[model samples]
Target: MRLTRVTTAELDRLEFHAVRSGEHAKVAAQLLELANQVDAGSEISRAELFVRAGEQWEFTQEYERACAAYQRAIDDGAATVVDARALRAGALLHLDEIGQAYAEFERLEADEPSSLQTYLHVAESLYAHDDLAGAERWATEGARLFLDQVGDPYVDDLLQELLRIRFRIRADLGLAEDALDRCTDTD
Candidate 1:
């Protein structure tokens, strides 16, 4: 394929759009290449690029690549270190490193996550691992911290997802209707 140069600004915008559109996997390789092009002096941005790449891979179910990218970001001191770590932990869960993943989650909980997405990922990861109590704790806490007693359509949407997850978790714990939540009900 013939190559065309992509401006950094345009690249950044494309990355954001790709992620927002849930098509990040299509651009993950480009992001990884851009990350490699970053020099040591630009460590922060380099780390950020790696984190972005990792997120793309993570969302695409490419857990091994996600873990590697996140680790690179962490080792480079990415601005969103906590988020990267949380995502890395989730990817670790997918990798079946349960003991290490649980340890990482416990550690991050002490630090508290730095973003709403981190909270969501941790909660989702725990839920997937059948740690209902842990998932409920994180999801509820995420809602409390992020929703701010007000509603934005976007945050509300995220809130709805969390609520659905929590409902299932509660049911699983026998604290609610024992039948599994279809997760089909919507606001």
Candidate 2:
């Protein structure tokens, strides 16, 4: 297989399908080989491959390995990429590095204040860290942002899912009124 011409986006899609088909180990090795094929100074490729490897390790429950891959991505200038920070933040969260994850998300939020996934992640992480108020605020922000910006009817299903989770989390935190209002609005 001529892997040299493969793009990072292609590798990412391949990795996803590989995981879905339970070829995690195969995907991991392929990602590592991809990393090796890139020159050390090829920061963009390095970051992307490392993130792929990290996600594979995460799926395999190799948290430490995942963390290392994410670290390599960072070391390879992931900070310069479009969604690198989000990927890094998600990796940190998966590794249970809550504080670091929070910092990364906060930084991303500051820069891209209306990103739905970022807000969703921040809310979920905050809820995990037992910050109900913070979680509620983030979830609310995420839901509103999604409604305002994401207009594809194809995304309606996901939006409904987000609404469900938001209400459930809010209700869990005793924000029943707010949850009810949001639910009605979504309907």
lDDT string for model 1 (83-181, tens) is 778878889998999887888888888987767767777888899888889998897787667666346777667666766777777777888542223
Distance from true location, Cα of 181 in model 2, Å: 5.3
Q: For model 2, what is the alpha-carbon lDDT of residue 66?
A: 72
lDDT of 2: 0.66
lDDT tens readout by residue for model 2, 135-156: 7777777677677545676455
Q: What TM-score does candidate 2 get on C-alpha atoms?
A: 0.66
TM-score of each: 0.71, 0.66
Clashes of each: 0, 0
Per-candidate Cα RMSD to the true structure, in Å, reads: 6.1, 4.7
